[model samples]
Target: MSAGAAAIRVVVVDDHPTFRIGMSALLAATPGLEVVGQAASRAEAVGVVLGADPDVVIMDLDLGDGSGVDATRELLARRPEVAVLVVTMLDDEHAVYDAIRAGARGYVLKEAQPQEVERSIRSVAGGGLVLGAGVARRAMEGLAARADARPFPQLTDREREVLALLAQGLDNAAIARSLFVTTKTVRNYVYAIFTKLEVKDRAALVVLAREAGFGGDER
Candidate 1:
């Protein structure tokens, strides 16, 4: 926290003391970063996040007392500006979707290289979303399985198609091309998707899709 230091304040939340220590050391020694706090449990993690007001939170999705997903939700609800970057061993499709639902800005596997983790923190801090290598695939499969069953069941054909692509992580351009429509129309469809689904963002929509049966198949 110096003049033009380029530092990103971060907190490490993991149950394993050893991993926490290692991450703390790495973040402390890395350029443009400062390890502001550490937490070992769900409640502790929430407290540390709220108290420290760190720019980025490096968290494990599996905490001792509460799910890391819930912690992320609480942290974001309290301070939505604070970014949550999930750095955990849970890479399953459901786990990934759950993290997204909880409002994580990024996701990275614990097995990722140290630099990759740092990059993720920086990316989230700078307002860019990030995801681990295999997490996107998991999300996509999760989305596909969800498209089979309609969450709304009341959406028209176009709205359902747009929602399906939205759950696939497609922005307006991609959705437009896929549906042979203009970007403006795609944006309108996206608006309708959110309005009908009663979700706020793409992450939440994707989670709903999986819950609706979007992840049972890979293709």
Candidate 2:
């Protein structure tokens, strides 16, 4: 959906000038999104974010001044309303887990296609989290085996119910119908599950379910 005529305002922060420029152009042209500012270092990033007050911050993992993870934490602490989305080459679990802990709304590998990056921006801005495809699954498996932030957490009963449905490959609509709730309600549950379980998306949800010895029928 277009989600109304107002576009998603965003700032691109990366150490690489080329990456900052390329992402700025790509995101600006995407539907329902606009690149309001750009920065190539940690200091510049903070300036752009504070100056633009954008809805989303597309941040690189390695900036000129420091790791983007640091920036993510600081930004959230400073501006709790503004969201950070990590878009970089770092695929390490530490990076992914740290970013999430730092209050990142989404994590996209640099290898993710341009479309995926744009989709992530929208997803996070729309109150959802995006995890790298396999990351979610791996996190789940680790969770099933051990309660670790590797990056799963203590999933509550209701959250586990939601995750189970997600593992069955149910979309928000189907899950809502099965649970006799509204789609918006299901979306909220899914987001909570992601944060609590430390899984990123449906694919990871499934992997974690299997590793935990759960099936669609288990719920």
Identify the leading candidate in terms of TM-score: 1
**TM-score, cand. 1 vs. native:** 0.65
lDDT of 1 at 178: 76
User: How well is each residue in 1-219 modelled by candidate 1, as lDDT tens digits?
Assistant: 467866899999999999999999999998789999999998998888888989999989888898999999988999999999999998788888788888898999998998889888989999988997878777787787787554576677778777777667778898788778899999887788889878898888888976775534322
Backbone steric clashes in candidate 2, count: 2
Candidate 1 has its poorest 10 consecutive residues by lDDT at: 210-219
**Whole-model lDDT per candidate:** 0.85, 0.82
**Per-model root-mean-square deviation over C-alphas:** 13.3, 15.1
What are the per-residue Cα lDDT tens digits for candidate 2 across 45-142? 88778989899999888988898988888888888888788998877677788889989999888888888888888889988989867666655665
lDDT of 2 at 135: 61
Q: Which parts of model 1 are misplaced by more than 4 Å?
A: 1-3, 145-219
